[model samples]
Target chain A: MIQFHNVTYTYNFNTDTCKDAIKNINLKILPGEFLAIIGQTGSGKSTLVEHMNGLKKPTVGEVFVSGQDIWQKKFDITKVRFKVGLVFQYPEHQMFEQDVFSEIAFGLRNNGIAETKIESLIFEALDFVGLPHDILNSSPFDFSGGQKRKIAIASTIAMQPDVIILDEPTAGLDPYSSELLLKKFKDYNKNKGKTVILVSHSMEEVVRFADRVIVMHNGEIKMEGEPRKIFTKVEELNEMGLDVPQILKVFLELRKLGFPARADIYTVEEAKQEFFRLKNLTKGGKSFVK
Target chain B: MLNNMMVGQFFAADSIIHKLDPRIKLLLTFVYTLLMFFIESMFIFTFNILAIIMVYKLARVPLKILIKSIKRMLPILLISAGINIFLIQGETVFKFLGINITKQGLCMVSTMIVRIICLISGMLLLLYTTSPAELVAAIEKILKPLKIFKVSPEEIAIMFSIALHFVPVLLLEAERIMNAQRARGAKFDSKHLKEKLKAYITIVIPLLISTSNRANDLAIAMESRCYHGGENRTRFKILHYSAYDLYALLISLLYVLLLLIFNKLDFFKIVM
Candidate 1:
């Protein structure tokens, strides 16, 4: 479990230009849950999420990963990092390695895993991300942006962290690559039972991957609930500079158009099922407007 | 951080120095430094100055950059000159207020100043033309034979690469911290030593905080890739030398040989 108890981070703490990035907000994530954190730019999403793995210690509060306080001197911070794998936005900017195999092996080497284990782990990670083993020796820089994205995620997966946090993982990818990455992440989460947390700007991604949606506004959580529940309040999300999923928006507009449709759909699959049911109901020729 | 740091720093131009192997460059600087320490006459110093000019031109570094580098070392230059001019035991020309001005002392100070400037500019010219990435590439290649000794070149390359990558980030953080302190009414421009000291201290503390945070994030990013230090790793883009590189190396050798020959025979010391 990961917990943030009244965590607040003030950048430039000693200087006059010090500004609060995150206010006193308490948050908790249970084991094996996929949570999506959504907020406007500069809403403290990055700062708040970085604290999950002891990347940033709170200035005023505490962050606990598992049962131990991350800041305690007795606990190894590096060990904390091994459990929480974070893939930064534009992670490709840090890719200085020659090929995919070495790139994926970077984390394992840091953990001091045996060379024999490292090779197998690298291949397994590449396979898990749908990249071929033959591409191991290929330069990461030569790959397409989407392929590089997969390699980056595979790099993190090779660490075998229990909790994986991705920051704007699909910021600039085609819809096809984006869907591919999301599907791979879902498969990883389900098959490995690893906790996945994503910070994204896309409402559709949040609706798709997130089991719980966390809406942050002005360094505080405006709302937190299941996607279906939180997204139903379209007005609240709009006020926070966020949007509900397109399907949910369409149903809300349908209600405004005097249709008896409920606006609870958060996915295309769910929307398709609901649309078929509505079509069948109307097919009975019962259009008596009382 | 200071964004302007990237204006021309660490860019590899097609200059002669950029083509020289890093090991050779390192050797050149070491030789230059040693020569500067042993050489005393103005004529030898003049030879050093000419060598400096040759490098400055060959590296394609602007004269203004050499001047800027010298400017930062002005305080040390002045202090060394002041001590030499006042304390050295020599033939005194005049004495004013118990201060003696000697003929040899003045000459010594001049030689010292010129030697120091020449030494610094020669090294700075090397850095100005060689990109950090290219330098690391060269270093990794040079260290490749270490694999016979069971050493890892990839680990060394990664260390240098990470250090180079953070240079810009560190400078940017410093700029932000300075601006933040300025916004808080910290008088960085104050002439008072104490106030300036306080302002600098304020700037450094926050910059340190940001650096550590960046370090943490960078560590995690590095670890995820299974970066075991220097073990059985291959490179992506291997560096190679062309005919131009060989030509540049030949010219540098000829220049150094000319300097060495003149110094060995003592043909130019009379000009001092």
Candidate 2:
């Protein structure tokens, strides 16, 4: 539901140390799609996602959300933000309310949602993030880091924006919590049919959940396609300081050894299926095994 | 908006002022500011302004950047000058909107503005030429004598440097928190004062929380690294005074002498 046309953003503009954070970005996000943006550090992933919610206006081009130009004169930017929720990196540090209930209700209240409906929405968000209802009265700061991250996510999801953009949502979390959190976002996108744009560094997570992947390097979009297609260019990705999933690396090694295994196998499940299929082919007696 | 803050910011350049000893620069700035208050004549003020302009040229700092730095103080300057124009009572030279504008008021306002400008420019010149580390070292050197009173100049200097280093970090954090609040639909640009205050509350609470959290983490990290309050620690770069420092001190002494001479000369003095 968000589109960027020739968007270029420069930080510290008009200063001697001015830098182009993102340059000449032309992108489009479809409704209900799980889009993952992968890049090295300072590769403009955060800047690109920040533009989706109009948090950072592009210095050069136009960003359109749901067919409306967000930066147009007289356009209400708050409205755009309400429709496109952004969960910043280290979002738990942005928590301010005294308790979990008020913390989750903060966005709903700011968006002028009905007072009576805020409680229900907060409960719904807590449910979505797997937080319990009993801890609503407790202070958010008293929770563990993962719980705090869930509370932060609940705070954003309470607003129920049509498009949710998360910048490194799973950063600093354990692997299990990261996977669980990504699953929640997947459920949110699948069940609600809402657009989800994730800025991530994990190739495995992107290959697992992302319907489309966009690789960024040096303030420009380097590649864009399905995960399988994107992972096929392992050398190019490595040159840009990015890596493919481990399963794909194994399959690539098999291909190099004269085995006919598929090189595009990303997830472990796909690798298992490919292994069985190869075993079945080898069972014909004329084996191609190295 | 916070990026416009030029206080404590250094502009790196290869110039005589930038190469001079930081201790000398600090002392000269303090002495120049003191001398600025002793001036009683327009001629001395003009002379000080010319001297400041010459120093600016010697420092090789761009004129536009200097003007931009001064522009941030325009509101305070105008407000103070406006108050002086209307409130100071003397011979009424003119009237505007039923308020008398006195000649003494005009003279006092001019002197006040000149003095403030000279003081600010002198401080800014010192900051623009000297890096923060050097400034802290110079401060420690100046306060070294206080060691006799059970004070640790090294610890104070480390604290000062840390405080200076965190200013930009906190500003960046504040900006991030502000954007996060805005993304939550908080309207910071509202015209109502109450709404604006409410918006800022969201930013302030988060900023304070993060600041303390950061401080705690930094303390732990320092402890892990065996940091022991700067006792018996060696420095990487030691401060040294050269011939240029002596030259700078002599020039400032001459400038102070000129100010004293002009204070004695009543021919160019303006009666307030």
Candidate 3:
């Protein structure tokens, strides 16, 4: 588990006008959990998670990852970074290689992995992201936006990090690209049992992929619970300048309109099943199968 | 990061000074700077100060901003003043322990200090009022004749604009890299100059690499956007001169005349 105990961080502390980015707080994230952190910009969500990878340290408190003090003097941060791979927003911007193959291999090479095994690992990472070998030799700059995002994620995955943290991975992507990315993330979580921490503001995306939801506002955790539980309170989330998944909003509307529908439905499929069951009951045993 | 800092140096304003034709302003700045060197009298200094006040007023620039400009020059100003007070040979003021302060030396020192202040103030006024992009365009226009020598004005313009734009970006990046290094146990102030230099080198290497990448990315992005050169390019905001500009030129000329009168009045002696 990754834990934050009474952590507080103020950026630009040496200057007179330092800003408190994260307040004192305590939280624990269990292993293998697909956790989604939702917040507006400068809400301390990014600051809190950076501590997990030793990218940032708390000004007052301590951060422990996998029961080890990350801020310890002898702790090899490169190793810590390997354990928790962070893919920042617009990950494609970080790509500097001439081709996709070399781009993915860059991280593994940095980690002192064997040269012979690098090709196999690169291919595996590419396959995991569903990119073909033909494109591997091509310039990353020549690829489409969605393809670039895939290649970026593939590069991070090649390092075989135990925990993958992505910040707005699907931002600016088209509907199809977003769906593809979400599916890949879900696949990685299910098949590899990797701990996934996704930082996003997309309610639909979070509700679809996250098992646990973390809500942040003004440098503090506003709420934290299961997706169903957190998303059910449409009013509270709305008041906090956040929105719920469209399906959840629809369910809430249905409930308001006197329909006996569940308010916690996050996906379209779940809402569809509830609607179908309700229709059948109202039809008095008449099966209206479409 | 240094580039980013320079970018922020070109403050933006929408006053009369900002609205002046950049080409005219550039030429006027040079003329004004040259005239300051010619003026070796207290009356000329008074005239210069009046001109500064008038420009500041017309620009609607705050006194606080003017004070800020002065504050930035304080260290150099004080240094020059100190050197004149102690190091230079002059008529003795008090004969402090075999030291002499000559009357001629004191006069020379004060005039030099005034000239420096005037030069600094003039440059600050120019930069404070003009946007960096407009200054780039102005410089490009002035250097347009150099195109006959196979010099690409467009390329130079792009370089100027890019440099201006990236100053803040680089400064922010430096701060980020420095913070990252600090978090990794890199001490910038460990009472050892070599260790401090090493810390700075670590910061500089990454900064240089990232800047290179940014430059490459910017080139690609610009190319993709069909930025061939300034040859066929038309400005989105074309500058024009108004009555205010004519009046400003007239005032500047009058100020120079007053400076000449001051030299004749013997308020201060001409150095050359």
Candidate 4:
């Protein structure tokens, strides 16, 4: 598990325009868990995640990643980075190689891996992202937006990091492509038992895919629990300027109309199941009441 | 990472200096730089220094900022001062370690140092009070009359405007590229020089490519948006000189007159 101890980060410290980005945040992230971090813009979600792999260090406290202090004097931070892969927003901008083959090979080459294994790793990553082999020798900049994003992710995956952090991976992507990417993430977590932390604004994606959810407000953790437990508190989430999934909102609205319904239904499948149960109850002249 | 650059950095305020017209500020800076050579006596330069101090106070620029500017230029100041101290022989005033300190050299050096300081302060008054946009506008206005000589002052003004606007954007872009490379384990902060150099090569290659791409994109964007050359283009902001500029002009004229009067005086010369 990765742990945080009284972490606080302030920008422009000791200046007139000093601001507290994150304050006294302490939490533990278990391995192999699909964790979703939801927060408003400027709520310190990015700052907190940047500290996971030593991209940033807390001004007042410490972060221990997998039982080791990330800021140890002798620690090779590059090794930590290899273990915790971070894909920033607009990952396509990270693509700088002349061709897709070199792009995916970039990470492995930097880590001192053998040249013989790089070809196989590149092919495996390409397969994982579902890109055709013909595109390997082509310029990454020539592809469509969704294709470029996949190539960027493939480069990150070639390193085989135990933990992968994706920040707003579905941003600017269509729903179909977004679902495919989410399914890949789910498979990675299930098949490899590796940690997957997703930072996104989509409540639907967070609820549909995340095993656990953490709600943040003004740089502090307002709530954290299993997605089912977290989805039950619709009122509190609304107060934080956040939303539950549309299915959950529909279920809540049905209850408000005087029909008994579950507030924790977060997916379309769950909504369909609830509707089927309601139909069976009404067919026998049974009354629906909260 | 490069965001703290201070070239032409303006201090935002509502003081009289800040309120003066950019053209008037530019004109006054030129006058003060030339006036530095007119004073013939140490006492007059001392009086002039006091006047500058009063003007600086009127501008309300923090002394801390002024100190930082001087500190940034300290090496230039010290080297010039040192060169004068060792060379230029005259009647010796003091002997230290069998080396002579000349009277004329000391007088000339102090005068040089004061003049340099005054010139820099006068230049900084404009930069500290006037924003970069205003400075470029002032330049355009001053050069407008040169159009009779077949000059295109507006084009130069546009160039300067574009340059100033992109400096911050380019710095941020470079930082972003560096961060992207860092995440890929490029090791920019490695202790080994060769490794660090190799890491920088990775960043620089991408930076160059991105810069060219941005340039092409900007050109296309401008063209597609119907950006014509600076011919018959009406300005959005028309600079107007108000009573504040009139008062600044009068004060600058009075200072120039004082320097002209000091040109003939040799009392309190203090050659040493």
DockQ of the candidate models in sequence? 0.02, 0.83, 0.10, 0.48
Q: In angstroms, how far off is A23's CA in candidate 1?
A: 0.9
lDDT on C-alpha atoms for all candidate structures: 0.77, 0.90, 0.78, 0.84
Question: How close is candidate 4 at the interface, in terms of C-alpha RMSD after superposing the true interface residues?
Answer: 1.6
- Candidate 1: stretches off by over 4 Å: A284-290, B1-272
Task: Tell me each candidate's RMSD, in Å, in order.
Answer: 16.6, 1.8, 7.8, 4.4
For model 3, how does the per-residue alpha-carbon lDDT over A1-290 read when each residue is reduced to its tens digit?
Answer: 78888999888675555898999878898888899999878888878777778877788898888998888897866677777888777666555567788778766765778999999898888887788888878888788878888898888888888888888988988888788878887888889898999999899888889999999988999999988789877778888888989878887777777777777787888988998978877787654342
What are the interface RMSDs of all the models?
14.8, 0.7, 6.5, 1.6
Of the native A-B interface contacts, what share survives in model 1? 0.00
**Which digits, one per residue and each the tens of the lDDT, describe model 4 over residues B180-262?**
67777888888899999978877777677777878899889988999875678887778998988888788779878867765
Compared with the true structure, what per-residue lDDT tens digits does model 4 show for residues A48-146?
888887888788888898899888888888888888888888888767778999888888989999999999999988888889888988999899989
Per-residue lDDT, model 3, residue B28, is 82
Q: After superposing candidate 4 on the true structure, give the runs of residues whose Cα lies further than 4 Å from its correct spot.
A: A284-290, B32-54, B69-121, B146-159, B191-194, B204-237, B256-272
Q: Give the per-residue lDDT of model 3 (tens digit) for B1-272.
A: 23212411655667878788877788788998998888777656866787788877877766566666677678888888767767777556666556776666677778888888788778777777888888988888888899899998888988888887877788877776564443333456557898788668757865776798789999899889988776578887777778877987897788667677776677665542
Q: How does each model score on TM-score?
A: 0.55, 0.96, 0.64, 0.83
lDDT, candidate 1, B102-200, per-residue tens = 888887788889888877776676577766777787778778899988888877888898888888777865664453333223456667999788668
Cα error of candidate 1 at position B32, Å: 31
Give lDDT for model 1: 0.77
Candidate closest to the true structure, highest lDDT: 2
Find the candidate with the highest TM-score and give its number.
2
